[model samples]
Target chain A: MSQLSGNTKWSVAKLKERSPVRWHERIGETSIFIISLASILLIMLMAIFILKEGLMVFINPSIRAEVNFRELFLKTVWQPISEVPKYSLLPLIAGTLKTSFVALLIALPLGMLAALFISECAPKWLSEFVKPTIELLAAIPSVVIGFFCLMKVASWLAHAYEIKWLHDALTPHRLNTLVGGIGISIAVVPITFTLCEEAFHGVPESYRAASIALGATKWQTALGVVIPTAMPGVIAAILLSFGRAWGETMIALMATGNAPLLDLNILHSVRTLAATVGAEMPEVVVGSSHYHVLFLIGTILLSISFTVNGLSQLAISSLRKKLTGG
Target chain B: MNANRRRFRLPKGSEASGLALTLLSAIATLIVLSMLAIILVDLGSGGYRKLSWEFLTKPPEQGMTGGGIFPAIFGTMFLVIIMTLMVMPVGVLTAIYLNEYAPKHALITRLIRTSISNLAGVPSIVYGMFGLSFFILFLGRRIDSLIGAELLFGQPCLLWAAATLSILTLPVAVTATEEALAAIPEELRLASYALGATKWQTIWRVVFPKAMGGILTGAILTVSRGAAEVAPLLFTGVAYYLPQLPLSPTSQFMHLGYHIYVMATQSPDVEATMPLQYATALVLLALTFLLNLIAILIRVRLRIIAGEV
Candidate 1:
C-alpha cells in the first residue's frame, strides 16, 4: 500500500511538471487557422491572376487604340495567328450559346419529367434502382463522351440526318453544334436530374396530400402544385447546367470539329470559347499577345460561368428562404 | 355542402388526361435511361477487344498505333496519387475548420463557403490557364532563376500538373469531408467535453473516426475526377508521346485521356488507331467507375453501421 502511494505521488508530480502533448493548444489553433486561411488566400490569388491577365487586353493602350474594343470583342473575326490579327469574341459566344441552349432544350424537359417520375410516380424499387444508375452518368468523363461522339455518334448523326427533307442543301456534318449539344446533354441530364429530383423531393408531403385530398389526380398535383412550388429550384438547376455545358471543354474540343464559324446553323460546326483556349493555348508563346488573348478567352469563360453560378446560387438560397418562411 | 361534394368528386375525363401526362413523363425517363444504356453497351463492345494483357503492360509501338497504354496508365496513376496526397490534407482541414471550429452564420464563414462553392464551378480550362500562367510561368520561373537552373520549373511537368489538379479537386474534397463532419452527432462532441476533453482532443478522438468514411469517399471522388481530366493536363504536364514513364515529379508524362484525344484527333491514320482510342476510353472509364463503386460501397456500409449506432 505504501509503495503504491509513493508511485502515484511521483507520477502526479511528473504529470503536473511536464505536459504530455507536443503542441500547446494555442499553437495548434493558430496553425489550423493559418491552414484554413491559406486555402481561401490561394483561391483569391488564382482568381485575381486570371482576371489580371485577361484585363491586359483592356489595359494595354497600344492594343486598345489599334483595335476597336467593341468591334474586336463583338464582331465575327477571330484570326489571331494570321498577319492581320483581329480577335472578335462573337463567334465563340455564339457557339457557346447555341450549344448550351440546344443542350438545355433537350435536357430540361427530359430531366424535369425524369425527376417527376422518380419523386412522385415510380415505385420504391424502380426509383431506387434508377436514381443511382442515372447518377452513374455523371461519373462518365467529358473526354470519353467526346471520343464516343467523335467516332460513332458523329458519323451516325451525319448519315441519320442525311435527308434532303430538312430543307437545306448544306447537310449535317460529323462535327457540328448539334452533335456537341447532344454530347453535352448527356452530361447535363444527370446534373439537372439530380437537382430537379431534390427540388421535387423538397416539396412538402402536406402539399401533395392536400392536393390529392382536394380531388386532384396524382399527375395533376405533381404538374400543377409540386412543380410550381419547386419551379425556382428547377430553373436554377437548368441555369446551373447551362453554365456547365457552356464551360465544358473536352467534349466541345473533340466533337465540335472546332470550326470557328459565326453562324446560327446547328448542323454546321462551331468552336466554343472553352474549346478555343484548350486547343490554342498550348502552342502560344509565353508573354506574347496571343497568350494574353487566350487569357481574355479564359476571362470570358470565367465571367459567364461566374454569373450563371451566382444566379443559380442566389435563386436556390432565396427559394430555400421563401419555402422555409424565414 | 354541394360545392364541397363537387370539389371532392373526380371530374369526367380527368383520369385519362392524367394517364396521358404520366405516360409522357415516363417516356421522358425512358429516353434518358436508354441513352445511358446505349452508350455503355456501345463502349463495352467497342473497347473490349483492346483490353489485352500486352495492351496493359507494354508501351506504344508503331507510332502509337499498336502499343499498349502502360506508360500512360503508369503516369496517370502517379499523377492521381500525388494529387490525392496534395489535396486530401488541405481539403479535410478546411472542411474541419468550416464544420467544427468556425462560428456559424459569421461573415467569414459565409465568405469562405461562397468562395469554396465558386471554386468548384470554375471551368477546367481556366484552371489549366492558372496553372500555366501562375504556377509554371510565375512561380516556376522565379524558382529556376533562384536556383540557377535553366527553364527547370518554368515548363510543364508533373509537379505543376498535380498542383493544378489539387486545386481543381479542392471543392470536391472539402464538400465531401464537410458533409462527413456534419454527419457526426452533436451529442458525441458534448459527451467528449463532459468527459473533460479539450476541443482539439474531442476532434481527434471523437469526430474524426466517425467521419473517416465520408472523408475517404471525398478523397476517392477527387482522385477519380482528377485522374480522368485531360484538359488541364493539356498544358500542364502531358506529353504528346513520352512512352518512357515520367521519371520524376519534374518529368513530362503521357496520360490516358490525352492519349485517347491524340489518337482521336491528331493521329496520322485516325481509322487505324480508332480501336485503340475506344480501348483507352474504356480503361479510363473503368478506373473512374471502379473508384466510385468503392466509395459507394464504403458509404453504404458506413450508413448501415451508423444507423445501428
Candidate 2:
C-alpha cells in the first residue's frame, strides 16, 4: 500500500507542474496578442472619434439651420467666414478633384514610361543609378516640395504664362489650380514610377522571351504582353498615387491661392479640405460646431482614401488569383 | 531575304532606342537635381551673407529682426532626438514580434499591419488634431517641461513634441524594421534552435544583430522626417521665439520649422527679413538632404557588407 501511494503521488506532482507550465505559456501568447490588438483598436477609436464629432454637425438642428446641407453641397461659393457661412463643398471638392485628376493625367503616362525605360530598355548600370535617384524623390519631405513649388515652380509658371498673350487674357490668376496640379504631379510621378517599376521587374523573363520568339518588337512585347501581365499592379500604383494627391496639403496650401470660390477653370485659385483643415484646425475652438465640421471633413478624407486603398488591394488579389489559376 | 533584313535592322533599332532611353532617364534624374539646385541658388542668393555663426547661435532678438535660428534648431533637434528614443525600441520590438513570433492568419496581426499602412496615408493635419485632443486636453497636461513632479528634458519641452512626431514616424520605422527582420534567413533561426537555444535567445542573439544596419537606416529616415514635419509641431507647441537657449531639457524652446513658417507667412515685417526666411528654408532643406544622404550611405554600405559576407 505504501509503495503504490508513493507512485501515485509522484504522477500527480508531475501533472501539476505541466498544467502550470502550459498555463504560463498560454498567458504569454495571449498578452502579446492583446498588445497588437490594442494598437489597432486605438487607431480605430481615432477614426470613430473623428466620425462621431463630424456627424454632430448633421445631427444638431441648430448647426444644420446655420448652413443648409443642400446649398453647402451644391453652391458655388465657399465663404465659411461670411455672415452666413456658406459651407458649399463644391469649390473645395472641385479644386481637389481637378488638381488630383490633372496630376494623375501627367503622372500616369510619365511614370509608366519611366518605369518601362528603367525596367526594360535601360542598361544595368543606368538602372542601378536610376532606381535610387527616383526613390530619393520619395524620401524628400512634402514641406520641402511645397517650399520649392512656392518659390520656384509658381514663379516659373507665371513667367512662362506671361509670354502668352491669350493665356494671360484668359486667366487672371497665374497661381491657380493648374499650377498646384502640376506641382503635385511632379510629386506623384516618383511614387508611381517606383511601384510600377517594381511590378514590371516582377514580370518573368520567360514571358519577354516568348513574345520576342514570336517576332514581336521590343516595344510591342512590352506594351502588349508585359503591360497586360502587370495591369493590376499598374492600376494599384495609379490609385495609390491618386489617393496621395488627394490628401496632399502643404503643396496645395502653398501653391493654390487658398480661395474658397467655386470654379471649374484650372486657372482659378481654390482650397482643398486638407488645406482647410491644416490652416484652420489650430485656431478652431475645441468641441465647437465648426470644430466638429473640420473633423467631419477629416472623416470624408479618410473614407475616400480607405476606398481607394481597398479597391487597389481587391484588384491586386483578384489579379493574382486569375494569374495563378491560368 | 526578309530574315536577313529583319535581323540586320533589329539590333540597330534597339541600340538607338536604348541610347534615347538612357538620355531620358538622365533627364529624369536632372529634373530632381535641378529642383534642388534652384532651391539652393534661391536661398544662397537671398540669404548666404546672413548665415553667420551668430545667426545660428543667438536667440531671437527684436521680434527676430536680428536673425537667429539657435532656438529653432535646438527645438528641432530636441524633438527629433526624443522622438527617436521613444519610437525606435517599440517599433523594432513590434517588428520582431510580427516577423518572428506571430502566427500567420491571426486577426490581431492583420489588424496591426493594416492600421500601420492606413496610418501612413492619414494626413499630418489629422495627426495634429489627434495629438491636441489626446495629448493636451484629454490628459490635462499643459505643454510645459514638467510632468507632475518630474522635470522632463528637452526644448519645446520634449515630451509633447516627441509624442506627436513619434506618431508621425512610427509607421515608417515599423515598416522598415519589419522588412529588415523579414530579410533574415530562416536557417539562422533554425540553426540556433538546433543547438538547443530558446526561441527568444536565438532571435536576440542572432537575428537582431544581423538586421541592425537596416534598422538604423530606418531610424535615420524617421529622424529626418520628424525634423521636417511642420504642421504637427504647430499644434503640439513649438514656440516661435525664445529669449534663452534651451540648454537644459526643462527650458522652454523654439523650433526652426515653426520659425520658418512664421517668417514666411505670419511675420509682422515680411519685407525686412524676406531673405532671412529663404535662408532658414535653405538651412532646413540642406539638413534634411544631408540626413537622407547619410541614410543612403548606410544602406549602400550594408548591402556591400551583406554581399561580401
Candidate 3:
C-alpha cells in the first residue's frame, strides 16, 4: 500500500490539479465531502434557528412583556390562549419528566432483559423469531400506536383498573400519562433492545469463560459478569432510550390528553416539549411570541437530546477504549 | 461496598436462577411479539373492509369522512419518491467517503463521525421546526425572491417536505451503505489494484456493484421512513385536507400518516372517522412492511452470494 501511494503521490497531486480525469475524481471527493458534511451543516443551522427564534420571547421586550422568563417557567398554568396568557414551561417539563420516567421504568427492564435473553440464553430459533418481531414493532407508525392507545388501551386500562371511590381519576377523556407512557414504552423497547442487544454481543467471550472457570454459575456469569462488563454500552442504551421517550411526540400528543398541567399523577395526562411544539406550532401567528414559545420548547428539546446523545457517545467510546486497551 | 457485596453474593441454585431468568426473558420476548401481533390483527380486522379499488384510487369527499385516500396515498408516494431521489446520491456518496476516502482516525474524520451520530439522535419534530424556519421561511422565501415569484416557494409544499425528510433519513442511508461497504472484504480491492485499476476505477468497477444491493436497501429504507414519519411533515407541507393531487413539487400535499392524524383527531365525529383511520393505518403499515421485506430480501440474497463466494 505504501509503495503504491509512494509511486502515485507526487504525480497524482499534479494530475489532480490539471488533468480532467483527476479533476473528475477531485470533484467527486468534494461532492462527497459536501454531502457528508450536510448533516453537520443542518445541525448547526437547526440549533441556531431554534435558539434565535426561541430566545425571542426572552430577549425582546415586547414578547417578554407578554410572558416573563421567570414567571413563564415558574408558574403552573399554560393557557397561551387565556385572557391573561401564561406560558409556564414547568408543567410541560414536569409532564415530560413524568411520562419519560414511567416509560423508562417500563422499557429499560423489558428491553434489557429481552436483549440479555436473546444474546445470552435464548435458543437460536427463539432469538431469530423474537428479534425481528420486536424490530417490526419499530416500523408501526407512532400515530397508529397512539391511536391504539387512545381508542383501545386507554379504555381497557381505565375499566380494568377502575376505582369506584375515585371516580374522577378516570376522566371522560380516559387518556392519561400512564397509558401514553405504556404506548411510548412499546415504541422505545425496540430502540433499547437493539442497542442493548448489540452491547451484549460486544462483551468478550473470554470474560464469560473466565467467570465460569472461576466457578461462577451460568446465571452469575451472565448477570454479574456479563452485564457489568457491558455496563457502559448498556447504560448508553438506557440513556438514549430515555432521550427517545422524552422526545416522543405523536404518542404523547394523542394519548396524553394534551393537558398542560403540573402534576406527578401518572394516571392523569400531561404535555411534553415535543408534543407542545407539534400541537401548537400551526395555530400561532407568524412571528408571534406564542410561536417563539413553541420554538423555545423545540430548542429545549434539541439541547436535551443533544446532551443525551453526547453522553451516549462518550459511554460508547469509553467502552470501546476499555475493550481495545487503548 | 454494597455493589461488591451484591456481586459477590452468589445465589445457591445456579440452574434454578438461570431457568428463572430464561423464563422471564422468554415471557418478555413473548409480550413484545404478541403486542405486534395484536396490533396487526386489530388493524387488519378494522381496515380490511374499508380498503377497496375505489379506496386506493379516489379522493376524499364529505369532509374526508366518506371518500378514499387516493390523494394522501399519491402524495405520500410523491414525497417518498422525491425524498429518495434527493437523499440516495448524497447518502451513498457520504458513505463512500466515510468508508473509503477518509483515513481511520483523523480529526476531520472524527468530527464528521460525531456530527453523524448527533444528527441521528436529533428528534424528528425538531427536524420539522428546522425545515419550517430554515427551508420554508429562510431558503424557500429567498429562492422565491430570486425567482420573482409570489409565495411560490416560500410556503410549505412537496418540495420542502421532501427536503426535510431527506435530511431526516440521511443518517440511516449513510450508515446502511457504510455497512454494505464494510461487508465487502479488503481482498477484493487489493485484487482490483493488482489488475492495474485506479482507485476510482476499482471502486466503480468492483466495489460498488458488489455493494449495490445494500445501497439500494438503504435507499429503500429511506423511502419507507418517509412513509412512516409524520411529525416532521406536520408543518413542512402536509395539508390536513388536500382534495386535489399535488400537481407540482411546489404544491402542498396530503400524506398518509397526517391523514390518519386528521381523521382520528379533526373529524367532527371521531367515531364516524374510525373506519377510515384504520384503513389508512393499514395501508401505511402494509407499505412499510413491503419496503422492509424488499430490504430483507436484498440482504438475504447478499448473504447467499457471500456464502457461495
Q: Which candidate ranks first by lDDT, i.e. highest?
A: 1
Q: What is the alpha-carbon lDDT of model 3 when measured against the actual structure?
A: 0.86
Error in Å for residue B76 of model 3: 0.4
lDDT digits (tens) for residues B1-309 of candidate 1: 999887678778988988888898899999999987888888889999989999999999998889799999999999999999999988988889999999999988887888787888888889999999889989999999999999889899999999999999998998999999999999999999888687898998899998988898889989999987888999998997884679799999989899888889999998898888889889998999898889887887888888842
- Model 3 TM-score is 0.94
Query: Model 1's CAPRI class?
Result: medium
- For residues B209-269, write the lDDT of model 3, one tens digit per residue: 9999888888877788778899999999899876578989999999898888877777789
Better of 2 and 3 by TM-score: 3
> How much lDDT does each candidate structure score?
0.87, 0.74, 0.86
TM-score leaderboard ranking:
3, 1, 2
Which candidate has the highest DockQ of all? 3
Report how closely model 2 matches the true complex, as a DockQ value: 0.33
DockQ (Cα-based) for each candidate: 0.61, 0.33, 0.63
**What are the per-residue Cα lDDT tens digits for candidate 2 across B1-309?**
998767545544765775676677556555644544565576667768788888878776777777578778877897788889987876776787788887788886777887777777777776776666666655434433346534233222446667777877888898889888988889999999889566666777899898988998899888988887877766666667767666654455677766776676677887787767776776787788788888888888887877942
Error of 3 at A1 (Å): 19
